[model samples]
Target chain A: MGTRKIVIEPVTRVEGHGKVTILLDEAGQVSQARLHIVEFRGFERFIQGRPYWEIPVLVQRLCGICPVSHHLAAAKAMDGIVGVDRLTPTAEKMRRLMHYGQMFQSHALHFFHLVSPDLLFGFDADPLERNVIGVARKYPELAVQGVMMRKYGQEIIKATAGKKIHGTGAIPGGINKNLSIAERDGFLKEIDQMLAWCRTSLTIARDYTLEHLDELADFGSFDSNHVSLVRADGAMDLYHGNLRAIDKDGNRIFDQVDYQGYFKYIAEEVKPWSYMKFPFISSLGPETGWYRVGPLARINACDFIDTPEAEVARKDFLSVTDGQPNNITMAYHWARMVELLHAGEKIRELLHDPDLQGGDLVLKGERRGESVGLIEAPRGTLFHHYKVDENDQVTMANLIVSTTNNNTPMNRAVEGVARKYLSGAEITEGLLNRVEVAIRAYDPCLSCATHAMGRMPLVVELHDAAGRTLDRRVRD
Target chain B: MSDSVTITIDGRNIEARPGQTILEAADAAGIYIPRLCSHPDLKPIGSCRVCTVVVDGRPQAACVKPVMDGMVVQNSTPELLQHRRNIVDMMFVEGNHFCMFCEKSGNCELQAMAYRFGITAPQYPFQFPEKEVDASHPDILLDHNRCIMCARCVRASQELDGKNVFQSIGRGFARKIGVNGERALGDTDMAATDKAADICPVGCIVRKRVGFEKPIGQRLYDTRPIGSDIEEVRA
Candidate 1:
């Protein structure tokens, strides 16, 4: 009685290509499972020798889904290169608007287009019916809201960044453009409607999580460290802040450390099996240091939400776990909605501010040779570091994307789900779906994480103890 | 006015100076013959045949072809438009032009010309040739990846700056703009204010620490076509 292997390649409903392998022992009990990010794109190498100013626009090629995150993060790093510690008010506000717009749209997209099908219809539902189109056919109103909400956020980005594709909004030291009065007015007209829709989506997620708390509590859930950016006073700050990492009980492992010195506190570990790298706290090393990021992690690590509406929502979310970190993987959806509401509130506040229309757009100071930029992207914290030559050519680049940060946690979630759901030698559709549900909770962008390319179809393969294929199932 | 010569361009009668080339005559008459190498202050070099025009029955480089009295020239015909577009397309593929991230993006004449010609993407396959970036100069950078070998900088260095700092070296595929000094641009007498440093039509030669100074919509040729200034004269 040797072990058998079950493989799910190109996990569906996620941003990029990933594979899940569940190993079963002689008793048909799950022994191990891993989420393998298979694609390898040498983006960091491609960025070498490029002019420092081009990085903000160049790094956007990493992921189309979260180009804004890369754009802003690279811009922040380049700002340090240009020797500017702080941007002008107008520039800061404009970039914040652009970032919140990105957060709003990205979170909305993950919830509606990617995760809603699974939530609306149980995870065991037919594969064909578990998609956005299926949602449109059965839940037309929700589908319409998702599309409109995503579009609204995109429109804000276009107005701020100057276009939907390859936006050049953020630049070194500051943003390239200011929010015009007309642009502000345009968003103002739709703010109320967007806010209403945000509430509705939050209600759906909150209700769903609360209704199935007991079931989801044990479903792919685990206790782990959480990392995110927090304002100096410990409020959740997506755009800019110092680093904060907390353990599962919400105790601060590290607090208020400048991200510029992140390499001192955080380190990345590499394994032969996957293209993605596992990130963990340097002090705790590889095993206990690994942490979660994105919505669930941010929700747990922050002392409070800065916005009014989102503050209330955060309290309710915290009450569910008795003011402790909620480690339930499925709670990611609810956490995401709370963030969505915060982004909306922040957007409305920024739009009404006079600073957005200010004239000064950039500030310059003494330049530096090396710098790091960090931002809490929709999925998680994104890091961009670079070393520039005196001639302004980029000599080195290192990126730790959000998905890559969650590498270990995703594998752990896969293993947890596989152990609980997998049974017998024959592969079942229900088991395959559960594994995906766990991975999708993280909203991992395999493409961005691995810098991969090409088509990704969910493929599940069953192999006997001898490593020979017994049965295979594919969903494209 | 007395030395002006009359020419028929695109079926329209236009007056030109006796020594002016077709491109010069077209410029004086508010008609635009698109060009890359030809500049107002530099001597015309008849390279980068983007300004090719049919003089009478044969095609000629508008930048070098003198305007003869009663000369007939075809400028913006359908065939000529496609020919110019093809030339621009070749320039796009010949170099690794990452227009999206290039500092000279909206302000680059080569990029503006492509926009004017309605080119969403280059028709030819991208060469993606290995290129060198020379950033030895303190205030300027020379990225060979964006060079189209139009000789604007070469002519400007020789005729305008009077420094002879830049010269074309090698031939055909191996051709590149070589600095006067043996090593790098830092050793050369080239200054940031040199006419050659500001004459490149692409991102080949750009000032350091000043990229993306102007926002997108406010950049040159953002709201209008490349030759809108000359075309606006007609209106």
Candidate 2:
């Protein structure tokens, strides 16, 4: 028999489109497998020559799910162009509040809507039964609580920033509006419930992991470098902080460095197969420099969470790693819940602060021509760099998104799972699911990284000798 | 009483004052006729046909067509609504409207109308036309790409500001808003605070030193959909 290939099209339930192809050698043994991203969006090319002020709103179209992250990052970058080191207390708090809402909603979306079915049901359950609708039908209370939690977070975003998606609360120097007493009191009523639900979600995650400990660890776990932003005291910080990265052995690869010298530490390598760029630590080079970002990386890299309840939960989580980095990819769900609870507490803290309602919202200044804005988005560390002329027109722009940072690790996880599960010429549905589950663990936002202007349906084709298409599947 | 006349619009009987255009009558009655170029303060210029309504079995520009007594008008008919959507789609394609990148996005009447119509994507092919940005103005910037050629700024400049700083040049696809006969807006007496500067319905005319101040979501349309003010009053 000639070489055989199996392809799965339109990997479902993740943020964007992806496909997996596994190649079988003549002996019907799995040889090579790849997860290919099919779209390319050159935002960097189109954004050039636009006025610097518009970058904040322009870059937000990158991803509908996480527009707030891009919106805040771009606005922060513009702060440098306008020549401000820090915004006023009121401005800072308002932005932090907005960011907390973003994190809470995004994490809630992933947990309750996207991944909970797999954790609740078996991974090989009926495909139709492993969806949000099924979760609602099976566990009505959990579904309702998740929906309410997401709604509460969204209301905060709407009240504070404006609308939930692509809100324009953050500007170059500061924000336009202040949080009113009424809005504060309104959110205050929900804080207790939000916090409770978040904690319950955390407990659920813990139960899931403990119940499936060995399988979770061996599923997609791998050793790689981890990167995230942290406060000076080594607390988990998403909005404002310095870059910190740790190697697989929990060694400090880089610590407390400003991201302006990012090129000196991080470099991106491009492959022709995908539009997503592979970023790594420059010194170590591509082969071994690949690192993971997002919740797992953030939890591993941080000394402790600043929030009280989350801090207590953190110690329990660290016991799993024995103070070393936890490389199990499934732990991202657990780490995400921990951060969700922290974000709930953070939102409550910021909302009650008197400084948040202050009148000083903006700081006008001179132009600086160049600046870099780096923050930890829900997916991972996001970087937005801009170079403007004296007229404040953008001459150059570079964005390193979270999913791009996790690309190498995601690919590695795909390979690991495929190698572990695939055995013969016949590709079983259960084995295919294992490969997809590996990718879903990272929760990669392929849409954000690709920034595709238009969309096409996901298509997978099987090829034989002379590259003739034998079987094809398409998902719209 | 003699100046008032009654007309049927979308099967609803509404009073119309004599000599008032169909759009003006509909507006006074709290019925929003989708319009782009016909501002209440400005004289009706039927440049944009977004407010086309079927009158007595024929389509007419509501902003310019006078309301006749006992006139049967169809504004929200399925066919008329589709026609209006097409006009809005044409306007979007005629200009380089990157609503994603536009500063006037949330506040833009054009974008809001598109939203009201539930236009996720324009059905027509995008015409990526080459346009110019006249940033020579120290106080204001004019982006030709976003101009729908509605001439609101032209009317605001001539009739309100008393300075003809803006005018329309060329015709057809080549037609564009000009800064005082091809001269830059900076060379003219157009101040940043002038009504003409604020008259643009799109991101064509932007005031310098004041951008994204209101933030996107808190802007005019973000709080509520366009025409909500008029529609809600009657509701």
Candidate 3:
């Protein structure tokens, strides 16, 4: 059967500027599904040869949403070469606390603000209901829960880092602020309310899933290698750790890999079709090697969660599908809520640490050298690596962002899911939207993709070796 | 074989080694000090009064306070703490800081130090400074309301970029961190990878432009202390 071109430009709800295109054969099989991550932001190249201490500030600019994570990761990356001797214990706790706040707020933003519109209202709901305002109309309570959860997260950040966005204080040397007793008291008051809201929201999301159980599961089932943040002790850690990538066979393909290792295992091949590079893991070829991130990877990577509440929720999560690596991409929403629960409870634990009381804020004693920082961004694993020479100047920098982490697999998964669901030539909006939803589920930050802005109409027209336009579509 | 320096902190005869600032000496002497612009990672910009100490009958910022042989550094003095408290007062009023409505209330350095110094009310009339907030980027945020005018962010932009993407727009209290000609960050050539946002000590400068991506609990600073055992920098 000859192929029939089907187009869905301007991918919706995801961060940054991007578009996707899918091509189906006359047999109605998805012949080519491409996620054209069309943002060319060269943050790494621009950050070269600056003061090592300034990296946290500079790299944080790469993506505004996860700057707290990037800032910490940048600081840690510098610490990998330099040191954090200038920081005090209290400052450390404050930074961790602020990071948790970002995680909570960021995940909430992705789940509730960005993607929940699709989950709460059916994917094929009226376009008006496909937006956040629609969620407020259809389910006012859930919308409120989202606002409260996200607001509390931002509140925590403001309290610790002094700003809701691009906050400072958490760094290689130390943190800037100590949690005040009043701040502690306020957080305590807000925690329970937010947790209750999280529960209600998650339930609603679960209910939505239960309603579409068949569609959700059968919609997306592409498989690939997965990667994420792990503690040196191999624990589930979003901030401060080396990285690990596992193949679909449940075998460890790469362990404790440094940023340089990323260069070896992952390759970024630029296609003229889009500004973003198609990231592929070397062990797996472009087509077969699909990967995933966000809720799916977080649940898969950790042996267990740290919070008791989250642990219980995890079991409930597993029970929904017998818990053996549920690949339902729609589950990203429920998984996101589970992670939010863990964050809320985790905040309480961090707040109570006695050492969190007053201590030296800035060590001001010495500047550090080179280091690599890692954190699990809302999308996947985000890495910031910096090389600073003496004179406190940055000599080199490398950033493996969350979207980049999920690139190879994202492309494959899009095609796999699209093909499986689009087998019938009916071309319902539900089928097309689900394919895009799979990529958005990871919440990829394309602003940090390849660091460039190419001309409009970037399309990877798959031509057979003979150079025939087997498929042609634009990603603009 | 280091030069010995003597200074009196809160009536204690403390002998500080050479190259130790009065702030360092006072801190070594266990003085309760407050600060905003003096980061160990960067050069000292004694803008915040939290670390003000009395030395030789004049108040001095402890972070920038240099060590002198046979010098007297008075920390925790009623007069000095008052001055520090006074500075915090000005900061609280200069910005449109509504503690209850703010996201940084409990953890704000400005709030913590104010409470620490027992500064209850805004001694000075509120500036109620009103400026347009720049939310151009998705992850980072720029709130003009909470700025304390320390210029640390300016220093960061200038010192880091050497491109001078940021500068103080006006003189004195009216001075604000801004791009040249008052341009927004996104409007400039300054790369998003620039960490200029890291130098801000208050909620004024933020990364609000980034969008939804990171999961809820997996954030970097949420569960652990960033400065506890700075040795964890090894992590």
All candidates' lDDT scores? 0.90, 0.85, 0.67
On a 0 to 100 scale, what is the lDDT of residue A64 in model 2? 87
A341-383, model 1: which lDDT tens digit per residue? 9999999999999999998998888989999999999999999
> Residue A84 error for model 2, in Å?
2.1
Ranking by TM-score: 1, 2, 3
Which is better, 1 or 2, measured by lDDT?
1
DockQ of 3: 0.02
lDDT of 2 at A159: 73
After aligning candidate 3 to the native by TM-score, how far in Å is the CA of B134 from where it should be? 30
* Residue A465 in model 1: lDDT: 78
lDDT of 2 by residue, A1-476 (tens): 66666676777668877777777666666688777777777888888877777888788888888888998999899998888888999998998898899899999999999899888887889878988999999999999999998888888777766778777778889988888899899999889999999999999998898789989899878999999999999999999888998998789999998887787899999887777788989888999989999999999999889999999988888789887898998889999999999999999999889997899999978789899999899999999999987655688989999888988998888878877787563565566777778888888788777643212233455666456677776555
Cα lDDT over the full model 3: 0.67
lDDT of 1 by residue, B1-55 (tens): 4688899999999988888889888887889889888888888888999999999
Q: Give the distance in Å from residue A347's predicted Cα in candidate 2 to where it truly belongs.
A: 1.6
Model 2 chain A is weakest, by summed lDDT over 10 consecutive residues, at: A451-460
For candidate 1, give the docking quality class from DockQ: medium
- Would you list the rank order by lDDT, best first? 1, 2, 3
Q: Candidate 3 chain A, which ten residues in sequence have the lowest lDDT sum? A: A453-462
Segments in model 1 whose C-alpha atoms lie over 4 Å from true places: A1-3, A451-457
How high is the lDDT of residue A473 in model 3? 45
For each candidate, report its DockQ versus the true two-chain complex: 0.67, 0.42, 0.02
Instruction: Give the least accurate 10-residue stretch of model 1 chain B, judged by summed lDDT.
Output: B209-218
lDDT of 3 at A57: 58
